[model samples]
Target chain A: MIFDDVTAVWNQFNLTERTIEHLWMFSIALTISVILGIILGIILYQHKKYAEPALNGLNALETFPDMALLVLLIPVAGIGEVPTIIACIIYSLLPVTRNTYTGLVSVRPEILEAGTAIGLTEADIVRNIRIPVSLPMIAGGIRIAIVFTMGIVTLGGIIGAGGLGAPLQTGIVLLLPDVIIVTGLWVGILAVIFDGCAGMIEKRLTVRYGEW
Target chain B: MTSIHPFETIDRIELSHLTKTYGDVTAVSDVSLDVIGGELLVLIGGSGSGKTTTLRMVNRLIEPDSGIVRINGTDIREFDEVRLRRNIGYVIQQIGLFSHMNVGDNIGLIPKIEGWGKEQIDARVHELLEMVDLPPEIFSARYPRELSGGQQQRVGLARALVMNPSLFLMDEPFGALDPILRKQLQEEFLTIKYDIGRTIIFVTHDIDEAFKLGDRICIMHEGELVQIGTPEELIFHPETDQVAHLVDANRKYRHIETFTVHDLMSPLSKREFYEANMPVSEAMAKILSDETGIAVVMEGNNLRGTTSRQNIVRNRKKNLLLGDITTEPITVTPEDALVPVLQKMKTKNASSALVINREGEVTGMLIPDSVLFHII
Candidate 1:
């Protein structure tokens, strides 16, 4: 009967509207954070002076607990997917931004000079040479950000965001070990899936860019 | 056979007292030279001698601190920066081919930048790929990463020439190549120069390369122009001991024609001549054999001048075997070195010499007067 209950909870977990909503919230946060993180990374790469100050500020922000950012966002965004997404984007910005800046700047000066001498305009150089050459490093940063965001997103449930985190929080409050184990397993599986996807994409980008 | 006016000659590059300084260090010091239309000017010197700086100044890649650089009498500074760069082709030691771009796009860059139409750019790319000895179909789609160093250099040259610029500035373009590839590229560059007829300001530290390729060689030393002249002029009359040492290193290769064979040949033109088993009387009928007091020699179809009328007169010993009284004159082929010829003449006490073909046939006589002509 215990095994039946556990199986029933497992089947119901994926079907529940709140669980589905939580998954949707996690997906939205991940997607938005990745996009915003990449944009910020590119910005930091283009402006060296801004990179130091901005990265330092973000480093300071990262030192704060993830729950602190989640709680801080609730007053403004009112406990929904918006607050969760904003929090994830902010948290993910550091790795992606730092990595992109480092990668772009690390390109050999001769390679950039070759591009310029071959008559590539500044914009074309950035788009074609600098960005493509640095894409491997950028992808690495995004991979790190994805894993970090995945781990942190579960905390979003504390602020009324949905997904496996909500059920886990409830299971812990109600002392339901079966519910906790099921929800924890789902979160673990989701993190592994997110990590695997990021790793594959990073590898593909590295191969495409001719980076070893 | 067209007349090239000094003023109207296209591809003529003139640097008028050009100077460049980086802080306290003078990179190029008041160097002036003219590379006439269609001439290859080689700038050669050791490291930090300003040969490269001087070459770059012509293209305004390194703007001179002072002085005018003109192309066909028009100041280069007068043109817009992009326009000026487009008109002067530049190739550096590091080939600098864009790694991210395909070979065709890299080669087509200048034309595309100039707003050439799609058809024009495509045709230009293919034309240049073939011009550089690379087939377009095979190489066009490949990236720079797929090419060898030599192939990359060829593509770099094609990129430089995409706009068909009249002046080419090459800064140690072959410096990084292996010796064999360097020689090959040098030969190919010479052929390209002959075909294109652009004014080339080629920089190198190699004296052999300078002599092999330059129509005019400009030697630089310590940021100053030491000497500028043709290879012969520089070899014979180097301006300083430094220039002399540079020329002296190449002296062994300078041909004998640079000095006259006459300087060491015998002055006598009289000798006895013999016809195939003929009587002396008939042999005397030939003007070259007529003089009794001379020793005539056979050279191919005609009898050459005798050694001396006096020697034949004194020996009047008859049956006068042709070999008996005939003095074997010192001779040299046209390709022999002047130093060796001089040493042979001094050892032989010869007043005149015979210019002979490979088959030992005399083509001409080198008299003492001919030797004086070169010196005077």
Candidate 2:
């Protein structure tokens, strides 16, 4: 009985297409977040004096409500995927950029001293020693971004971006128990799966590059 | 090989009035020194003596507040700090090998940074590893954390040496190791010095290590250069009481080192003499009666073998001849140092050794009890 109900709801909502859209949004937002996070992190690390205020500002943005973030982007980006993806990137910036900055700056002083003593250029030291040593931390930051990206992408349905959240919102409006149960459970499961995969990747990075 | 070669024909380093102050504290004060080309000049002092500060200024790792440092007679400021360090090898106590890189890559880094080919870098890295006694096949792929402290330091040495920079700066590279390992590395360092040492500035707080490894040691105290001299010169002609105390504090045994065997040996005529034909029972009795408890068996003025109470008693029931029980005696010249003479006796498992003159005539006897007293 339950299987029949699930299949019925799945087809009614076109979950196959929504899953694709959901994942598509997630990948784009996460990619942009990581690239920007790393670049922003490097900039902050190079200008250490500005790191405090810049990070505090990012923290303030992080504390801004997620629903409000999506709502605010609507006026700038308008409805649909652009605003949704933009919201995901915005929320993810703090974790990725902060972690990247922390990882870069927290490299062992002796290791940095050794690099300097060996006559490595400033750029070489950053690329070879600092970045490689910070891999585990960077991976940790990316893992957090995955969860943020997944959540923001799902919420995009409220703005007519057409993902699993659309069906969830419909089920909520019409009070269709089957549609709510199936879509809500599916989105939750998908988020868990993505976060779990990222978690595994983070662990592997830690094993490979973590300081003893 | 050219990497080990200095930038110019001679790399004479001159530091004049080099001083560095951190706010109210002076790290190095008006330290002027001339390090000769290819000389392994050691800067030695207690902690905060400004030796490390002095070393860092040579490569501009720490710029002096005032004064000039010249390498190859050219001011160090004239060259890029990065390039200057690239041509000078550096090793430190912590042995900061990149935790992420394997042994081979750690040593190969300088060459790779210099834009050498992959194969050439690998070959050079392996060669440097061999110099430091790390087998390339086993250690090349192992990370720093996988190795022991001593092994990590060896890799650190290899990394510094791989590019063959003509000048080497070592900041207590073996200081973190246990005494046995430190001594072993010091011996190995001397061997490496024999092979490829350039103008090296080695900094250590250990006076003994300085005396052992340095051709000349520069002593620092409280951010000032106190004395600079050879080990012998420092011992015999220390210019300051502070410098004298630094040397004399650990040099009690050094007096024995200076003394020859003649200073401690006894007249051979006073030794217990027993004939080879004597009964084992009689020889054992005589050996037990003597203070040295040793018998120097003689065959009509020609030295036979020597036997002690331990030797005679172990064979007491065997009914053997005195000659059969005795072992060859260790013979040393009267001019030999007491320490080495003691070493010979210890290695040969003999309590007493025969002292002989240039004429091959047995002259004196060496008892280790007297040597033990010197150490105690």
Candidate 3:
């Protein structure tokens, strides 16, 4: 029976393990993107001369098609999680870096002057005034990166990395409608749940920092 | 009240040949001045006059191109830039209170930077809030946007004074406020300064404010020093035609001269002698009621001279008595021309005139405005 095969397919596949794998790969990519993006943003801010070139380069990285980036990395990094995570990090860098830079640079001049005039050191000004005022924008960038990474991690399964995407690809190869439907549902659900968490984090941070 | 400055004797702030340039345009060109400690020296000029540049130079906000700023006779360049700024309070027209922080945090910022303990900073914030007439319990947690313009400025003043710095640099600090609020804050600032006694360099385009608040005003025009003198000196003896024009706006009231009451008082008429002790307003009311428009001002039994409605009006304060209004009748002998007496009255801010004979006998009377009308 069709129902019997569909049930057998569900029993045969390790859905939980693939979802966990998907989350781990996405988390690794997101964490690296966050750290690298913020550092690059700050570096770009400090040496403004480097900002133009660095930003143009980052824009190029973002403009690279997702699958092409994954394919390009496969030659050196090979298949599986290595190339998949590398692709995810590159795809996520633009929003986090650009937004962090925007947040820091866009702080009001009068506020910065007030900070300096009050005798705060450069470090103190960055920590006390610039960072706090720019946090909401930075958080928005983080949310975007996290959601984008979650969606892109689906491609990891094509490279033989274990994730919710593996079954969806298998179903397409075999032309099985039921397999596609169930696995596609899981992908959409996983993406929404992770994106919601990121959005919640953004909201919490923005509320804590207060509006500028 | 604490000893905020390390220097024992901070007597003067001297700017020597101070100059600044922005690209091709000169913002301040070789301006020099000395301000005594506790003195509020007003720098007055139109836009592009370099008044603000000159003030900012003292705090190194705008570093001068070629000259030096010496605070307490020591070159400010010798002091560490951060430490120097920490010891100098600054307030600008924008009243840049940090929007992120509440009132208490804003006021406590300098102390925090100076490494004051949390308790000490909190206590000081409360104290400054009270000094600025904003109670801590109500204002401490409130952000700057919650405050009105005047209130935000008071917070700015509190923030500046919280450091209790050796000097204050105010660049049109009250320029953002409307006239009435500006006047009120100016008075409040004077009272605050009286307590703090911090040497302040105040910059403004307002000549009247310069006259009111400055112990000495330095006028700037096109990045050059036009003149520097006491308000009275500037008014009476303008060094340049430009200054004369700058001050001409208030020329009508700038005249100052020594004139006795007798010079402007009229002679006794049929009106009963009003004692010097009578309230000026009452005397004015009486003079206005009387058809003769004059009251004989008496010192005990001796009739001094007459006062006109104009004199009473000019000298009248809310509770000022006739005695306070009565000056010795500065009698102009009958030989004297009306023009000279009127000129003296104008200078003296007097309105009435006493026409007396050579022996100083009370004769006919003259009110300056009325007498000038007849004689002209």
Candidate 4:
């Protein structure tokens, strides 16, 4: 019966609109998290004394469950896509920040010497030499954040944030197998597609950036 | 052996009273030296001898604890450190090429930073790659990982030269390459040195390399300069036992005064001929090894003098000619002692002497076989 209703529910659902909302939340959250992560990462890289506390803070954020983070945000920001996106951003910070920090600090000393010896100004060294050299590793972090953010964005539907997770959460409450199965399938398919796209972008960046 | 321009003889770089210490260990101590424009001054010493520290201070890479670095008579401290460095090309043994950048980008970086136009930078990059013997068409797009060690070193050299800096500081630039490749690069760099005519401070631990590439070698020991002189002077007139020991390889060969062909040679004969004005040591070596063991000395292709090893052995006249000795005779002045003369003869690979006066006129001959016969 659920197998037959699965097609029925799919026919009634606006797959295009729901999928757009899912990706929109994931992308915006990922963009915000990546920018913040990069800034924090650079700060940590430049001031190694602050790295331990900053890294421990990021690690602590990772231990806090995404659902609990969203619930905690409800008191201040209230419910819906805003808190969901905030939670997703917080959850995604660990990988991007850690990778960027590691990548920047790990650039070989000889390479830095060459950069300085060539008369590159401090700004030029950071932007042209340090950043470009560390891009691939930073991209790796972004990829991980993309996948992790996509997972947390699914939970956005529980707080009336309109995404594929909405119908899936509704299905669980109404005891409807077709809604659960069909919405779950959509979420799974969207996650794979988003992850695949992120992976392709990271691969392209790694190829262009080259290995040391 | 490239002759530097006469007008460019002014001191291009001067290090006055330089001293640097690292936690009670003096890396370089009270060193003052002037490097003439267009001259390659090679600083050579064993590890911890302060050669590298002395070099780095010129570019202010390592600021001295107490000293002054003057470039072209201007205090380097007055200029911004970055600007000072931009004018000084630096190459080290470990290459340090940017792995992220392709060959063209790596070489063009300094020029680009100096605000060179894009097209001009590109052209310069191509020209530099060609100078380093790397084809730009094929190598421009290739990353450093795609190249061999020697190729990477060439790129490093090109990168340093791209800005056409007036001074170059090279610290064992070819030391990382294999022996054969190192020698090949050294020879190639020597040719480039003449063409560029930039003042250079080359730091190397290899005494032989210092002798080969340096116009003047500065030998340092225990953070102090032991001596600084041309290779010939260092060998012939070493200032101390340490200086003599360092140049011991060439110390045994005393510098013979330049004698005219008429002084050390006799009149020409009809046999095999050689240049009359050639160094007697060189001419004697040739005659001794020649098929006939005699050579007619020629001046501008005309027969000027003749020498025969056999004639000197048979002739016992007090005024015997240099040509009369059975063995190639060493040329020496008569003030020399017998033992020193014998030792000098042995070192020169000769068995007799053409004893000459202050005017380089041949006074008599010292034949070893006759001396041995008379003594017995």
Pitting candidate 1 against candidate 4, the one with the higher DockQ is: 4
- For model 3, the superposed segments whose C-alpha errors exceed 4 Å read A1-13, A193-212, B1-9, B249-376
Please give, for residues A17-76, the per-residue lDDT of candidate 1 as tens digits.
655776676677667766777788788777778988998999998898888888888789
* Highest TM-score model number: 2
Docking class of 2: medium
* Fnat: each model in turn: 0.22, 0.71, 0.53, 0.64
lDDT of predicted model 2? 0.83
- Which candidate tops lDDT? 2
CA displacement after TM-score superposition, residue B111 of candidate 4 (Å): 2.0
lDDT against the true structure, per candidate, is 0.71, 0.83, 0.77, 0.74
DockQ of all candidate complexes: 0.15, 0.53, 0.32, 0.40
Query: Which lDDT tens digits does candidate 4 get at residues A126-170?
Result: 887788888888988988898788878888778877777777778
| TM-score of candidate 2 to 2 decimals | 0.79
| Residue B366 CA displacement from its true place in model 3, Å | 30
Best by DockQ: 2
Per-residue lDDT of model 1, residues B1-376, tens digit only = 1111113335567889988999999988988888888888999999999998887776555788899988877887775555565666788888777665688887787676657898999898888877766657768888887787777888899988887877788888988987545655676687788888888889998876787688889999989999999887887788898997876534433454565554443333323334323333233334222322234465545644444433333333355534344566676775565666655665665544567757755555543322222222
> Ranking by lDDT, best first?
2, 3, 4, 1
Give candidate 4 regions above 4 Å deviation: A1-6, A43-49, A175-179, B1-10, B240-245, B248-376
Clashes of 4: 5
How would you encode candidate 2's per-residue C-alpha lDDT over B49-138 as one tens digit per residue? 999999999878899999999987888888877777888889999988999898998888878888899999988987887677655776
State the DockQ, from 0 to 1, for candidate 1: 0.15
lDDT tens readout by residue for model 4, B1-376: 1112112323567889999999989999999998988899999999999999998888777889998988768787777767666767899998888877899988888777767899999999988877776657767888988887777888899989886777889999988876545655676687788888888899998776787688999999989998998887776688988887876544332332332223332332334455555555454444433423344445664434445533322232334334333233466666665555655665664534565567854455554421121111
Q: Point out the worst 10-residue segment of candidate 1 chain B by lDDT.
A: B1-10
TM-score (0 to 1) of chain B for each candidate: 0.65, 0.69, 0.67, 0.64
